[model samples]
Target chain A: MNELPMSHHKHNDPLPETVLRVKALESLLVEKGLVDPAALDALIDTYETKVGPRNGARVVARAWADPAYRERLLSDASAAIAELGFSGRQGEDMVVLENTPQVHNMVVCTLCSCYPWPVLGLPPVWYKSAPYRARAVAEPRAVLEEFGCSLPEDVEVRVWDSTAEVRYLVLPMRPRGTDALNQAQLAELVTRDSMIGTALPRSP
Target chain B: MNGAHDLGGMHGFGAISPEPDEPVFHADWERRAFAITLAMGAYGRWNLDMSRYARERMEPAEYLRTSYYEHWIHGLQLLLIEQGLLSAAEIEARMQRIAAETDAGAES
Candidate 1:
C-alpha cells in the first residue's frame, strides 16, 4: 500500500465530473445572459447557511430531552430522525453511535466521503482528508488527541468505516454545564467536529 | 457495496488494480464549491436540500460515481439550471464562445 502513489480514497468517480460539466453548461448560460445569476446565487447561498449541522444538533437535543426518542434514535436512527422531520437525503440508513466513557466511535468514508447526512449534515473538510482517514482507523487515539479530545485509557475506540448500506453519526455525550440550557443553547454545542467524535461539544 | 467513488477492495481486504500516478486535487474547485454554496446558503438564497435530495433520490451508483466536490458541483448546477439562471442553448453557445475567445486570445 505504501508503494502506491495514490491512496484509494481519492474521488475517482466520473459522476462528479459529469456534475461539473453540467455546471459548466450552466455557467456558460450565465455568461450568455440567458439565466439569472441572482437566483442561482440565492439557491447556493441557502444551502450554506440553512442546511448545515442544525439538523444533527436538533436530533442531539431531542435525544437529551426524551429517553425513548433517544432509544429509538439509537436502535432505528432513520425512523427516529424522521420524527424530528430530518430524514431522507443521502444517508438514509443512518446509525447514531453514542459516545461514552466505555466506548467511542468515529466515522470515515475511506473510499470517498461517506457521511450521515440525514443527521450530521455534510462532513467537514478535515473528516474526508487523506491524513484523517488513514490515521483514524490505524491510530484512533492519536487522531482524537490532535482534535483536543482525550479518552480514558479504559475506553475502546471503534472507528466506523462507512459502507453503502449503513451511515454513522456520533451521538456525543452531551457536554456538561448544559443541563440548564434550552434547545437552542444545546444545539449550539453540536459542531461538525464534535458530532464526528473528534472534538467535545463546547459549552460556549 | 458500491457507490460512485468505490475503488474495489482498494481500501481493504482485497487488492485491486492501482491508479496511475497519485491524484492531486485542485484547491480552488473545492473552495468555490464550498464557498459559493455556503455563501448562498448564508445569504438565504437556497438550502442544501438538493444535496440531501440527490444523496437520497439519485441511484447509489451515481452517488458513488461522483467525487465529493463533484456532487456539490452537480447539485449546484442543478439548482442553478433548474431555477432558470441559464438556458440549455445559451450555455452551449457560451462554451463555444469561450472556446473561440480563448483561441483568439492565444493567437495574439
Candidate 2:
C-alpha cells in the first residue's frame, strides 16, 4: 500500500499546475475512500510490466506460424486474441488487419486514443499526437515514410479509425529471410510500431 | 462533441518526432494521472465513453495545448465533479493546501 509519490514537490522550483492538480485529485479520492491506492499501483504495474506490445507480438507470431490461427485471427480477432489471454477494456471488439504484399493497414483514433490496451498496453505518444492522428488518415504513405517505412506506390494503404468499442492491431507480414525462425524467434522481431503499422518488423 | 481531440485530418501540426526510446510515463504526475484515472474508473460511476466525452468537452484551444495526461486529469476532474464525488472548490482547496505543504517542506 505505497502512497502516491509527491517527488516533484521536493524541489524549490514550482511544479506544473497539472501535476499539483492530479496529486490533489488522488488525495481527495483516497481520503473519501473512493479509490484504493493499491488499485492504482496495480493498474500502473499492469501497464508498465505485465501488458504491452509483447502480448500483441505473440499473437502476430502465432498467426504467422499457424494458418488456422491466422484464419481465426482474421475472421474473429477478439476471440483469437482472447485465446492468448489478451482481452479487456478498450479491446472488447478487436480487428486484426493483415498486411499483405499488396496492402498495408494503419490504425488511429481520431476522436481519442482508442487503442488495444490489453495487447498493446497503451497507445504511443506519437500515435496519440495531433500530427500523427491528423496526417495518418490524410497521408498514410508520407506518415509511414516519416516512421522510416516507405511503401512502394503499388501497395494500397488502409487507415482504420478506432472508435470507442473497436480496436485495431496490424499484423505485419513476416519479414523475408526468416523461414527457419520459430514462433518465439518471430515474436522477437515484432516491434510496437510494426504492430501499429507504422514500421515493419525487424529483420533477423 | 467536436473537440480538438478529434484530430483525424487537419493541417498545421508539423512533423512527428519519434523519441528514440521513450519511457511509458514521461513524468511522475503522468503515471499518477493515468493510474488514478483507471482506478477511479472502477467505481462504475462512469463508463469509458462518458469519461472520453468529458475530456472531449475541453476547450478546443486549451485541449490542443495540453499534453495527453493533462487531458486525462481534466476529464477526471470533470467526472468527479459531475458525479458529485468532489466539487470544484474542494479540488482548488486541496491544490492550495498541497502547494503550501510543498513550500513548507522546501524550507525545512
Candidate 3:
C-alpha cells in the first residue's frame, strides 16, 4: 500500500533538503522498477514492529529460566538464538557475553554501527553516535557511569569491540527475588540497554 | 578504512544522550531512507559491507556533521550511482523539481 503519501509535505513549512532528496531517490527507483513500494513498506514495518529487543529479551529470559538453554546460549549463541527464530543479516555470527558477579561485559562497534539487527532491531541513535563508538571500548567504566550504571570495584569490565562479523549480546545477570517469575515475566525485566551492557535488568 | 566513521578511541565528541522512548524512525524521511536502502539492497547490486564502505567514503567533515539517516541516504546515493542504477544528475534534477513544487504550493 502507498502508506507514505507526498501530500504529507504540504504543510506551511518547507521540508528539509535531505528529505526531498530521499523522496526523489525513492520515486526514481520505483519508476525504474528497481524497487517496489510495497516491498519498501514491508521492510520498514518488519523492523518498526516485528523484530526488536523483545526478541533478545525473550532469548535472555529463556537463558535465565532454563539451565540447559543457558548452557546452549553460552556455548553456541548463534545456534541457540536461531532456535528461538532470531537469525538473519547482521546476526549470522553472534557471541553472547554473560554478566556474572566478577565480570561485566559490554559491546560496541568501534568501526561502525554493526549491531545484531535480528535480535535488537536497528541500533539506537546513541549507539551509532561518534562518542559511543569512540568511548565504549576505551573507557567503558566511565561510559557505564554516564549510563547511571556504576559497577563495584571488584567486577572486571570487558568491552567487546564488534570489528568483524561477530555481534555480541550481553546476557545480564538475573536480579534477585525473581525465583517465582515465569520466563515471560523475566523477559519483562530485560531492557534494551541492559542487553547492550549500558544498564542492568530491572529488579523484581 | 580509517575514515571519520572509524571513531574508536577518538576524543571530543562529548557525552552520549539517550532519548527516552525513542521512536524507530525519527522522521518520515528517515523511514523512507531506511526502507529504500534495504529494498535497493535486495536487488543484489551491492552487499552490506560495500554499502557501509560507501558511507564511510563520504568526506570526513560532512560524515561527522550529518545525522544517522543522513549517512544512510548519502551511502544509498553513492551505491545508486556506482551501480549505474541512477545518475547523480537525475537525483539532483528530481530534487530541484520537488523543491520547486513545494515553493509553488506555499505561494498558492
- Evaluated with lDDT, which candidate comes out highest? 3
What TM-score does prediction 3 earn? 0.93
Q: For chain B alone, what TM-score does every candidate structure achieve against the true structure?
A: 0.55, 0.96, 0.97
Which lDDT tens digits does candidate 1 get at residues B38-98?
Answer: 4434444455554444433445555543456766655655565567665566655665665
Residue lDDT tens for model 3, B1-108: 788888889877667768789888888898999999988877898998898998999899777777778888999999999889899999999999988998999999
Q: Which predicted model would earn the best DockQ?
A: 2
Give per-residue CA lDDT, model 2, range A30-134, as digits (tens). 999998998898888888889899999999999989999999999999999999999987899999999999999998887778899999987777777777888
Poorly placed runs, candidate 3 (over 4 Å): A1-16
Interface RMSD of candidate number 1: 8.2
Q: What is the C-alpha RMSD of each candidate to the true structure, in Å?
A: 8.9, 6.3, 6.6
lDDT of candidate 1 over A2-93, digit per residue (tens) = 54434343445444345345445555644565445676655444445555677888888888777899999999989998897876656678
- The order by descending lDDT is 3, 2, 1
- Which stretches in model 2 have alpha-carbon errors above 4 Å? A1-15
Docking class of 2: acceptable
